[model samples]
Target: MAAATASSPLNLLGFNRKPIFHCKLSSPRCRPTFLMPPGRVPSNSIARTGRTFSNPPSYVLTCLVIPPPPKRQKPKAIIQFIGGAFIGAVPEVTYSYLLEMLAMEGYLVICVPYNVTFDHAEITRRVSERFSSCLDSILGSGLPDLGLSALEVSDLPLYSVGHSNGALLQTLTGSYFSERIPKANVIISYNNRPASEAVPYFKQLGLVVSQMLPVAATFPVNSVVEVASGNAWKLLLDTAETVVPNYDLKAFGSFMTRFTDQLPLIINELAEGISEFKPTPPENLESIRELYNVQSTLLVKFDSDTIDETDQLEETLKPRIETFGGKLEKAVLSGNHITPCLQELRWEVGNVYTPADALGQVLKNVSVNDTRRLATTITNWLDLLSH
Candidate 1:
């Protein structure tokens, strides 16, 4: 007769709040649960072989290693990753995460650090040489430093993934090694504009700096200026703080040194490479196509990436690729030039009551992370082409 309480078994309508259950099936149905999609990788299961520096100091190579998953029964294919201009194999953790994704998917990946020499031809040649040596070391002699004894690299198909200028280098490598290695190449953010076009002031600055202090030209002084002027390391540092907070700061000195030492060489190479995109005779275009006879090529361009030259490049090369019975696939994605490699950060304010809320969005605008979706897109493309 007492007033009903919230926890009372009977409801206001005089019926029990909890409903009785009736089982239709004699036994409960069992359904399968999968932690991840079939054939996809679990992050924690991936293994890594630490970076092994190329012997003989002048070679100046660092092998960025990402071995395959342990449980896979069959041998894995290889992917050679070439970093963008001024970014060597070990510049940042973002690069590491991207490579790890490939490795996690059961692919053995070798990352060639950025070459100081801007000459794409020379860089391609050096990369090819080192790639062969690295392959041999893994298969036959077994380089102890690379933990190659654990891998079986014999006769496996090789593919290439290059970013920015490294994509240019990959193109050259594909052309040069068409017969021997690399079945195809995946080029990201391929920009073919002249270096001066991209940075008009860089040419003038280089000219003035050369006259004012030629000695500094050889000493990588320009690199120091860029860092101090907040042109180079600002975004990198900010991104690292949010995405990879414990990343070592000292590594920046080595990275900057490498970048600064070869600034002039890269500028000169850019000039030459960009000019090749100018109007050429039909015969010249035909000859250029002959040089790029790889089995297939995949070009990934960002929808918002204004710096890309792959559109122009594809128009010229597609015919050549088709002539050779090869295929060319172009994919346009969202974001800017760096979107494939760097993720966008979303910053939100805890409350609007404070003045700090106004600054939160501005700070968030500058933050970045490594784009996992980009890596997945590449993996899917590889799968499509692998068959």
Candidate 2:
């Protein structure tokens, strides 16, 4: 048997010594001491001691300890939306239309902003950070006081929606602050891929790593890495769409035509950019993927004309749909992506709907199972907020 070296013990009773160990110790000096005043006790001559004393009551030296108060209950719900790329170029008309629709049906919605002008890496970073901050704001800002008679009160459901790059932000929101937000009733994502498939591909090359192994060791494959790459791809696609001419022309035209009258409002909102926006990426991929288990529905609308390959888009989204146990609520309207945002759709593009009507449908749909109902829920909620 090989004897253990003095410095590195091999075994003790067949048990190898651990490389590191920890222990806890208490110091006598740290103990508190109580001393009575010299004059409080009478002098004693029996043992030639300066003073004699009786034992003090234990209660006299004990201090009362109070526990901290419990945390307050959070709001009933929180609604957040992620804005697409393009500085201040949110689908405002659609958003407003949806908000008003939801407000009418009694729900609160929050529109989140993301930095689309910056590089992809920067945008991803900002999306995560902004989401965290926005959640903090919503938690801090008490629920919006919707003035309604008690008789008309109802348990307003909370939901979130995101379009284009905004979908990434919504993913981050669900991943990072699920606990702080209300149970998401619906998550309507428009024209975007899942974050796991959109983030990582944003950069031209994968992230570099430095290690001390004899042969360079790489970081273990993780969900974050995969999700980041996917997110990157989505961002790249969005960037290309914005600059590439003739890309989704019909949808672009529809968005422009419908909101052309609200250009000033759109421009003003864009002017502020991410100054009023907050949301951040999730701490890890598992957190974001957990959103699939949430009881929320997702609707993905594509303009068949603008999308050269509809099958490709469907394939890309298939996994996400299955993961969430959700069916892809799709609309293949005659108009391009922009058609859903136009007034012709009666703003139903941004709001939820029950019957799943065409662009000309009115805002009369009202069943949760119906597309029109979802639309009404969104429109009514938006109407509750002024401006």
| Among all candidates shown, the one with the greatest lDDT | 1
Model 1 lDDT per residue over 105-172, tens place: 76778777655552455666787776654554445433344344423344356778888777777776
Tens-place lDDT digits, model 2, residues 287-382: 444443333334344334342233343344446546654433333323333322333121234366545454225442221123333364344333
RMSD of each: 18.8, 27.7
Q: Candidate 2 at residue 71, lDDT?
A: 26
Q: Number of backbone collisions per candidate, in order? A: 3, 65
lDDT of 1 at 68: 58
Worst 10 residues of 1 by lDDT: 1-10
lDDT of 2: 0.34
